[model samples]
Target: MAFNRTRWAALAATVVLAACGGGGGDIVPSPRVPFTSLVSFGDSLSDVGTYKVGTVAAAGGGKFTVNSASARIWTELLASDIKVPASCPAQTGLLPNVPGFTGAPVTNTPACTNYAQGSARVSNVFAPSSATLQAAPFNQVNIGLTAVPVTQQIAAHLAKTGGSFNGSELVTVMAGGNDTFMNINGVSAAAGGGAAAAGAAVAAGWPTATQQAVAAGGAAAVNAAATAAVTAMGQAGAELAGLVKTQILAKGAKYVVVVNLPDVSQTPFALAADAQTRALVNQMVTTFNSQLAAGLAGTATTVVQVDVYARGRDQTANPSRYGLSNVTTPACSTTSPANPLQGSSLACTTASTIPGDTSGFLYADSVHPTPLGHQLQNQFVKEQLAAAGWY
Candidate 1:
């Protein structure tokens, strides 16, 4: 007989619920514990709308997906599934110095708690389109995200809530993609030129290197950059784990779900990269996930790990199974004048998408997901949460 995925899922969920002491006779089991609110931290993948201002707001685009009233990212979906308050940006702002672009100053929303921001890194303060990179050479256009690192995001939350969780919020963390991107950019810069250029890249939070390595240039420089980038990613993962343990858990957080990095090497952005760059990205992701797992090894009771990497690999390998039609092509039109960031999904909307229907596409742009992709991610998270009896 043909396998029924829905039945299989239901059976698995029942089994998990039974193992967690739910009633075996019940067709649908209740959650083990109720979650009061959802507190999120990370980059664009989890961002609800930290940069929904000025031109981006005018174009009805934000959250790094095909922006619309119904376009909810994974975090929002998770909030709804768990029956918690709707997620909203904890902070919002965009101050771009680019011509023809109007931006709003940074503002804090005390009532909201979704802290994830587009282009945010795990610990690094500098990120793409960040206010830190708005000077001369980088000249990031569109709205400049604050790009507050995840470490500080937690700190800000603690400061806001009197430095401790109430043990009822469902905390989710997903970051480090931007850190990998910075490292890759450093490698590219090192491969292209002398110590001065490489040093500048490193100064932008790319990676640190010994004086000799920076002065080496050539293949030596490339190797040094790659090594540094990989090492830094591992450190980032460890840092995130550390934050969860010492900051969140120690402060009274009970249900924390840590999402590992997805295999970005399979994204359209990486698909456009050379073989060497793609390989480097894969290595960086591997190193980060390994370190994160190692750091969180003994915290199984309070922490649940979501393997987005494995899920992403499976989805890319078998898109049809996930109802994805085009995993390789972006659904957004890169040349549309309506999108100030050009191809960035942060500004993509229904008006700027490709001619055909894009609801089945996996990606909205080169790096960011479409609404369908976000839904797949939400489903994956829900399954994990259910298995852990947290939803």
Candidate 2:
């Protein structure tokens, strides 16, 4: 039989085209962008060490491992990719809370880069004014009593650089989680305690007004409160997104990555609630994410919105896909099921975690993610940044 060289060449070409057709074209090369400095603004999820000096000594919303000598959040992981130091702007002049000691206010050289703080919101409804900030005890550091809102964080960055960007910076914004929860709780409290009492509770730096309201109401009343709370949170979230555009994008920021809130109801704290209550919290999260996405539809800045809400749900639903074994349980131990968020010993290592497997758990406490979970979040950010060619 004669060897047909022409037919063999044609067959090889056909096989090559066929292989390229099956999802090979989907691999679009990332168009590289020159992005230098990295600026982040958000709450505890993105905070580096704004609360390292706070007087609180609890987990979840209270001061925990994200401060002091145990600071390892997503920002640090992301910054390491660029060989940049992940020191908090507040650490320079901030004074750490010393047990049984009182002294004059301490100041350090301004860093003006990482301005994230735990318990920070898009708008500090509780401490709305500087007068209120000075009077309240929100922070024990140099930033003062007010929880620096995402807006304030951006403002501080702008103030440091004379209110302008050089178009060579990569800005990261991950706020609205605290805003969502605070609005829901505030509205829930207002449903039963009246607006004045709810306002008073927040002013006093107490967050139990919502639980007090829930206790006073029946199932129907509670459901109604939840609905109202979701609506309130959605409104606030939309405004926060708008601020990101007006404040960051409008200020000449070229690259921006904004992360939406995840399903907080899936957290250990919300998981301890009644099924109906958990459903309401999840709904509030969805509504806020939707509103935020809608608000940032056509911004001039190269804005990339990461849907963390969906990612969290998927990780819980399919743990093994993300190499996770326990999605519903907190890595840290707790004494109270009624208040799961108030857990203890967030320091997760090979020894501290139960079953001696900290990598299996999705949560470190009632609300925050484990160190492994934080790494997963950093992976998500990396994927988005690479997709947008800003890595």
Candidate 3:
């Protein structure tokens, strides 16, 4: 979600179209069946197509709090497999499940909260006794939604007045990427000192690997963030499991799966930006996953680790292999730097220092992925969701 700029002193945080993908390939696959329902929550990654949207508009053209553009996320694609209720889309469809609720499951249940806003953090933005996206049309048939860090999401669910909200009964995650972004190195310039120097560096080809290595240094910082998140998740997960034991498993909900994050290093940002940076980021990802695995040790909740990064790289390495010769996004060049945050070296824009496509898989505007790029991610997500029983 955030990236570092080599020219600048400090790497400014910017949300990329990281709409990255990782369909649970090889490492583990899904059972290829729908859950009780399909649902999602998180930052841009799991925004379920609510990104840049105002609100879910009757499953057709509409707008919301975000920009007026109507964009449906991968979740909409799930209709091919999951069953969606007709009266429950584009708005809150949740009715109070029991006594505590006054026919209102949540305080702020909108038809579709998306739950995942751009650059959103893993915190509860819900109100007690309020309905969430569960009853909405966008994802009503697919599954339920929950943001990551797991703890906060559970807190909101547990606090609800109505019953039927238990962590153990469902998948316990919203996917992870911000964790990886936080681990990247930083660049600063005494507030405003490096602009000129940054320009000079650009004229020199800007040493992509070196800048990336610096980002790699951010691993420690990210580790600290992950540690805190993991600690909080463990405590929350245990409580959720207890609730599941009482409600779902004890009652009837089957299989509690906790998805593990993919290798963040393989994201388009890491790849286009710098090789050294990608390596460092990958290492940090490995470290964090190990820590997360340790936290999830010996639990009945199955941990599904999606290998998106490696799979993404494979797509990049031989894009043509996937029928992406003309459709794939381009990567890296002076005209279009690896990332917008990593703006072109001064000379690059002028067609002087850097020029034509340096990396074949990058986009002309290096930051966002091409349609081909989005497709690859779709493939990965489809693969993993099926393997992990997401249907």
| Top candidate when judged by TM-score against the true structure | 1
Q: What C-alpha lDDT do the candidate models reach, one value each?
A: 0.75, 0.56, 0.35
By lDDT rank, best first, the candidates go 1, 2, 3
Cα lDDT tens digits for candidate 2, 263-342: 87777656655676567777877888888899999963489888787788788788888878887776654444322222
lDDT of 3 by residue, 201-314 (tens): 222122443333333434543333333334433333343334335433443445443334444444434555556555655565555445545555554434444444456556
Least lDDT summed over 10 consecutive residues: which range in candidate 1?
Answer: 13-22
Q: Candidate 3's C-alpha lDDT?
A: 0.35
User: Candidate 1 — which residues are off by over 4 angstroms?
Assistant: 1-30, 135-142, 203-212
Task: Give the better candidate number (2 or 3) by lDDT.
Answer: 2
Candidate 2 achieves a global lDDT of 0.56
| Quality of model 1 by C-alpha lDDT | 0.75
> Model 1 over residues 1-391: C-alpha lDDT tens digits?
1112222221110100000000112222445678899999888888898888888899888768888888988899778877789999999998787688777889999999999888788887767657776665555443567889898899999999999999999999888888776666666666545655454365436534533464566777677777777888889889988988999999999999998987877877777666777788889888999999999999998898988888878777887788878888888887788777676788888888989888888888777788888878777776777777776
Listed in order, each prediction's TM-score against the native is: 0.89, 0.73, 0.50
Show the colliding residue pairs in model 2.
Answer: 93-108
Q: What's model 3's TM-score?
A: 0.50
